[model samples]
Target: MSTDLSLFGVVNAGSSSLKFAIYEAESCLLSGQVEGIGVRPGSKARDAAGQPIPAPDVTRQPPATPAEALLMLLPWLRDRLGGRTVSALGHRVVHGGPQHARPERVTPALLEQLTVFESLAPLHQPHNLAPIRAVLERMPQLPQVACFDTAFHRSMPEVAQAFALPYAMTERGLRRYGFHGLSYEYIAGRLPELAPDIAAGRVIVAHLGNGASLCALQGGRSVATTMGFSALEGLPMGTRCGELDPAVVLFLLERGMSPAEIQDLLYRRSGMLGLSGLSSDFRDLLASPEPRARFALEVFVYRVARSVGSLAAALGGLDGLVFTAGVGENAAPVRAAVCEACRWLGVELDSEANAVHGPRISRPGSRAAAYVLPTDENLMIARHTRALVAT
Candidate 1:
């Protein structure tokens, strides 16, 4: 019916959930997720306005994996297309290794290459790839693209990627590879439109969600980022330990702990969850009366502030600080605390603006400007997918 309309589909699959969105040009038409994939699969969807919409009937037999969940999602997405051509599907792949500096069309060879990176991103890579495989199997005609989270940081200088390890190991791909490139890429692209002055100068963007990381962008390109080699490298996150000395792993091993046990402790049992011995959701932690919750919040804020300072140094100086993602955009208290800690960097928060979740939250007199710009990783994926498909 609408021959002029073409839609782009985006999939961001995690360890146990599948999030999806449909886009007509740049506007998101419908978005939602199928969560609790293995144990108790359930789906919920909403239109662009966030109003409830009838979700696809996925309960005939609960999906046992991300791929199965995706299989169920495809038909529903097709119905919503309403005669419009679905150009391509874009995936949020966690790692792209040393090569693949840009969005790539999914192919057998590309899938093989991406599979190798699973060891580098155990908690994420497998799930991120499952849906792509499902699309390949179930809808072979559809063109799919893999938009990597590590792709944007490929612009960083070699010195920033080095780990001081032996040259041999570095040559063998032991260097840093930043994650959350989709979000950072979106923020970088947006900055020029929102604040052209800072966009051309030095800026640090804090993508503070469940998987938190900071990126130093100079002239809208990544110069340095907090996460290196793995998503577990930087910023204490929802359930992952942020930065730790390598000797700690040796100590754990000498104590008879296996590598798997160490991985579990560091990846799924640490961070705000372990620190608070409570919940990992920042909203929950912020509201709790428990001292551990308060302590956990304090640690998160402190690390973010300290990391912002670190990234600022990488940029040579601070021109702008951007807060994006979940905790960055929604949590006013966290933003205020981080701004207070960065007072030395000339970030003076406008209390009223911060409380209201500002697009710009800094005082006019502050040397460095601070902003709360919500990230749209899904849209970024769609744009890339559409471009690749058109080409």
Candidate 2:
């Protein structure tokens, strides 16, 4: 039932925010909108062009969930688009549980299978499915797709995906399932057009935002990544304590903390927000003079640099470095520190160009080139949605 109404939507359900984008076939016709819904409510909705729209009167209540947010979003989208028929809805499901390596149309059976992996990605998977469920209930006729963040990294070598635990645990899905695949996939897709030389070489793509990770891409495929098992395993993020010693979990448990409490602490109350005792926003930390905030920022940069080194090893060597997402694309100081740490690998930063963000920030004589490319996960999801629904 193909029609000119090739417009589709990509929903990225975050813990506090619900992002939705409308696309015209392949190209993104608009920017998208996000509604921040939670107990700590400060609600504002924006249209695709990023213009602020008056938010519906969603109250500051605990039950003000993502499903509620999605319900609110459908009308907003429909009003703005003048009732364009949504051909499909694509979701950025965080964990595909080793089995889903490609995008799939949402089904009751598929949703059930996806729910089983929620424990593996407690912070993201459950929320990811909320929109799918909402769409199923309210707009049952429209096709929906689930494009996994971990799916693209499925190409990583077996050695890169394993944990040092028991073989039984490995078989039970206890291994690296890298997040931020849609972001990296978008960057990889644009690399050939933006930087053809680096696109074909050993490259490391850093997706740094509120949630951060680095992926080593060889010829546009993931060879290694910093995130593993879950997004919580990567570099310290806005509120996530990444790569904590497993013993720390036992220690907390021994101190009488239940699994649920510990999970909340690690996934919600930790990372830069926990360390700084201030805001999770990097801009906040960067502007603060508090020692804790400085320390938190330093730790974030250190972890990113350290991960870059490890990923370079996985690639045998490094040809170029690409930074995207919010912090990677905007924060000058963070990029400077990371590139400085990677100087030994022949990354010579252009101080002026770095301050003024560029597609190429490395100096002419540098052995390894550096670039700043903004990521578009929505576009990637929309493309996948179109391809799957068309089939």
Candidate 3:
């Protein structure tokens, strides 16, 4: 097919940033992001080897919206391309409702329908669509695909997805819909080669980043996950308050807390930032000697351990655990603390291996294995796009 080309571009838009990657088939050619979108001084680019590529022009022109930021990023990317054609664009959308449980081509009708899902994922869905819309307007002829964050979890059994709510509400689509699907999917695909022994059994992948979640896989298929209904329902994130009691919302409402104010408090003011009042960055928290930082870390570890236990029950037993994402892959102390808490479940951490970022952190005698697997959601998205668009 003359239309087919090897190049594919992936865009992952979040509330505060836009990350884009260009891939020559499965290999990443280059990637970049404009963090602090509404804020300033956040444009950064890098080549395949992670070497910084300066973008002075992007720094000079500030983008007021995520859509504008991606549009601004186009020319610089094009210049870098020299003359290569991008076969298709792949986007990471957080919520897909039940109607879209797989990667779907982006259409005007689909985009309109996705808007109704925005209220379900207030902070992420809109931003996820911004770059897609920008690309649509700039390159109307370009083929694009949306790889949903909730799609992979659709494989979960009814028992795993069901809530205690009435049948009517549950049938109306108010049920657990796990996120970080792309990340978990990538891990599932790679787990067999990475850990052949544990790949065929019960395992958990902790995607701990600014936005975090735990996913349980039984033989490389999603059986359960920590996130439910929305991205805010799982583990404590960089700024989002996770797993809050339902009564708390009523109490706040009764006390005259405006919905907007409450949203701001949970989605922007909470997490390690709220607990420490110092910093949300795990590196900053670890470097600081402040008791507040220590307490915040303790809370995060406690929640992760608890979630691991819950997921283990879902699996009926545990064979291994794999940590991925920003914090999971890098923060040694965080991983150590969580693993120590899970000692009863058979995790013996090799402190030396962990400190140096070893893939296998568990001692051979440990019952449940532990490993650090770096996740590549962009690569996952590109794979899905290529499969769907057939380039």
Candidate 4:
């Protein structure tokens, strides 16, 4: 019989932090985060019931790099297991490029292939692999699996994936690859239960966090998405300048900006931060009384509403809309504004329901139903890991 693995580890490595959770047969036994990596790093954890557990060692004790952080977290995890064995480690790889359409067992070859997509997702790809390598060295016998953020959208039709570039350029692998697939996958899986009435129709899942994107789902499959080619190409994020005209890069280059400078500018200096010239945190902007903060929020809402229109077109119609992730789930004002902008699309937001961040916030007569749903990408990763390792 296949090994009925009981423990699974899920790691989501971002540019600045790693969020990890330990699961025993699908129940989260422990969850925590190591934040400020490469800066003033720190770690904190909690039990499945949400009780505060001690940090790996103490607050700010985690390493300042992905490799070091993974090494540190491994020992802590082993200690917490109390003799329980971790059957495998599952990773949330932000990019799978064109080849990886599903979870793949981590190998030297797989890691190498994933590295090739690093430049395509400069912010996430490298960090995602660091832990995989660290685990390989720390416990070579342990299995590792990688679940891709781009995998779920691999089912997108050719027309949705194509970039309208020359066939030669397209063959060279420059094309749209929708991101946040794992989050969308989780939301899609739950939509039937959360909003059964509209789950079968065309739905748009807006994952609005520090990183934001909209996935157009028809009958539970991706028909189109706002993010294409890279995470930097969709809605304005915490620092990313989304959906820039190609000529904008040319303009910057002609102005004597180097490629590296352009990369930093678009990926770090733009978005709400650039617009406000103040802060990137939506909470900060909302708390501020400054007009610039209001402008930044306006720009964000405007673009989100605009993307919804485009994605709706891709699906040929709209039935329901979902808001998820950080800003989508917590920022009631932002949701209200986006719903306000989309009023023309027949979205009638229930002011009271939106305020509480409930699962459903739409009016009965609304042509488009609006919902606030939480995403669980780690759960998705753990599920994939257990299935893969069982084989």
* TM-score, candidate number 1: 0.97
lDDT of each: 0.91, 0.87, 0.89, 0.90
TM-score of 2: 0.94
Q: Measured by C-alpha RMSD in angstroms, how accurate is candidate 2? A: 2.3
Q: What are the per-model numbers of colliding residue pairs? A: 0, 2, 0, 1
Q: How big is the RMSD of model 4?
A: 2.0
- In candidate 1, position 225 carries an lDDT of 97
Looking at model 1, how many pairs of residues clash?
0
Tell me the alpha-carbon RMSD of every candidate.
1.6, 2.3, 1.8, 2.0
In model 1, which runs have C-alpha deviations exceeding 4 angstroms? 1-5, 83-85
- Rank the candidate models, highest TM-score first: 1, 4, 3, 2
Q: Which stretches of candidate 4 lie over 4 Å from their true place?
A: 1-4, 58-62
* Each prediction's TM-score versus the true structure: 0.97, 0.94, 0.96, 0.97
**Ranking by lDDT, best first?**
1, 4, 3, 2
Q: Record all residue pairs in model 4 with backbone atoms less than 3 Å apart, i.e. clashing.
A: 38-64
lDDT per residue as tens, model 2, 37-72: 666545565665677767545563433778777777
lDDT (Cα, tens digit) per residue for candidate 3, span 1-391 = 2333888889988777888999987899899888887777478889989899885355677787778887887667777887566788899999998788999999988999888889778888999997888888888899999999999999999988889999899889999999999999999999889988799999999999988999999999999999998888878888888999989988999999999998888888999899999987888998999999999999999999999999999999989999999999999999999999999899999999999877999988899999999999999999999889983
Candidate scoring better on lDDT of 2 and 4: 4
| Distance from true location, Cα of 328 in model 4, Å | 0.4
